[model samples]
Target: MFFNHWYKLVGMEALNLLESFIQSAETGSFSAAARRLGLTPAAVSKNVARLERHLGLRLFHRSTRRLTLTTGGEQFFTQVSDPYSALRDAFAGAAQDAGKPAGVLKVSMALAFGREYLVPLLGEFLALYPGIVPDWHFENRPTDLIRDGFDAAIGGGIELTEGVVARELAHTHVVAVASPAYMKGRPLPRHPSDLAAFDGIVRRSGATGRLRAWTLRNQVGEQAAAGHRARLIFDDPEAMAHAAMHGLGIALLPMPHAAPRLESGALMRLLPGWYADNGPISLYYPSRTLLPPRTRVFVEFVVDAFRTKGLARRFDGR
Candidate 1:
């Protein structure tokens, strides 16, 4: 408020660009400021450059190790810092008070599971919060949540980096399933090793390109190798699931993709007692004490929808 009483602010860019200047001024390093801003060092440098161009003053002395504010930079920072913070706080307070999340929500999701299950929930999600605009990407691959600039991601076995957190949406359990037509003449496997006697619709690893073998685990904590002979092979689970449903052979498929078919009688679980527990499909986001309201509400909405819609249990491979 002191600065408010003393100074008239510049253009619109100043408000958005000032924070970058202030962060770099305080940290003395673009790398440090970038980390705080969840951006690349070059981006923070560019932001400060834009601010400098707007103000027609060189704000920082370029150095090999750290930045030092110019005399003019020092004066400007001192004048604007408190008012900038006050302006930020005012926006923050109003946003919290409104409790109406409105933003372009960016998200990454697994293709098969997202299509089979989550896509249906979009209408309801939008109906409840009409202001939110979802920009969704569906693909079968890993994403760097921060570098990729996604607000959140729905996935399984995503490597969590520092300053990121996960909330499990469902167990990413893989179960062996076969079309009923394929299983009609074949005897149901009595044990894990018995699967080897049957034809296998296996998955070739997308990351490694090697065949994915099943190491089955039972409820009693017993473990055994599946070693089913490969009758058909694919790198994508959706394709492998399609092959299995068409009676190609048994496939080791994650429950999210397999559950729909199993329920519809298009596919049936094989060796019911055994499954591979592949970590969990989770809602992942960058960890911040004060998460952006849009992202926060989205996380809450998905978790609540999963619980109420019985998707949690369905996707658990029970």
Candidate 2:
């Protein structure tokens, strides 16, 4: 009986050790894992060391800057990570019941797109799912969803990482736009080559910190009109659109942002046939067999909204 009791205690200790080791491995530092666990860095290191000794294998190669997993550790982590995540989800699921999707739904979104499309839909979404609290971040730049603890993110050109999945919400296309007031006196550009003579309001990429090129494509071929006279440069697409609206210059703007103004006769398409395909805007979240109720509901809501409102087709500029 005493032997069996001792073995059970050792088994429990092993589980704790493995948990600490996994936390350290995932966060890339004992200090980070310690912060998550509300423990000291030394305690986290001790736990990992105990786990390594118990397994009779070196799990990580410790360096001054970072801790990297050994081959055995990598194998172990791959085997356990999913199951561990599922276990956590299972616990979370138990706390909430069916028909009541309650919790904080943390989301990241692009500023202009979210403001134009998503923000308006929040009232209806909140009404439908009263249990859910929407906590959203709207910015020009992409966010690290996992590290930053986002439930989901909506934007185009998000970098896919391990444990992440994306669902296409809409296709995005860009077109050159200018206010009628701006184009009144200027010579109308019948061809791509004529753009060189006109002033351009350009946008710099938030991710790369470089001025974006105006690459337009049609039956003739894809031509990047890089030699336009840049009268103004801005980082945000909305800012560029506003500048173009006030007759600043022709701006290569996303179709979604330009559509309203185009409909209102506030902006005119510079070249009807030529456009830049920016690829699909997607809703990205961590892949899991069982997603959180709040996240699942929000995803469903957004997808349905896009389909019902014809947003996908509109974004495609069809």
Q: Over the stretch 1-318, how does candidate 1's per-residue lDDT look in tens digits?
A: 224423334655566578788878877888877755667899889988977765678899989998999998898888888777677545543553246877677889988788878789999988877878898889888987765557799988899997689998877688888999999988998887888888888889888889988788988899998876988888888898899888888888888888889999999998886888777778999886667777888999999988889998886754
Each candidate structure's count of clashing pairs:
0, 0
Q: Which residue segments of model 1 deviate by more than 4 Å?
A: 1-11, 15-49, 54-99
Clashes of 1: 0
- Residue pairs with backbone overlap in model 2: none
TM-score of each: 0.76, 0.76
Lowest lDDT 10-residue stretch of candidate 2: 1-10
Please report the candidate that would top lDDT against the real structure: 1
lDDT of 2 by residue, 1-318 (tens): 222222433654755676677788888888877755657889999998876666667889999888999998897788767666776577547545356788778899988888999999999998988878888888877677765557899998889988799999988888878999999977788766677777889888877888888667775675655346789989888888899999988888888889888989999988777778878989999888889888888899999999999888776642
> What RMSD, rounded to one decimal, does every model reach?
5.8, 5.0
Sequence-dependent TM-score of model 1: 0.76
Error of 2 at 152 (Å): 0.8
Please report, as a residue range, the 10-residue window in candidate 1 with the lowest summed lDDT.
Answer: 1-10
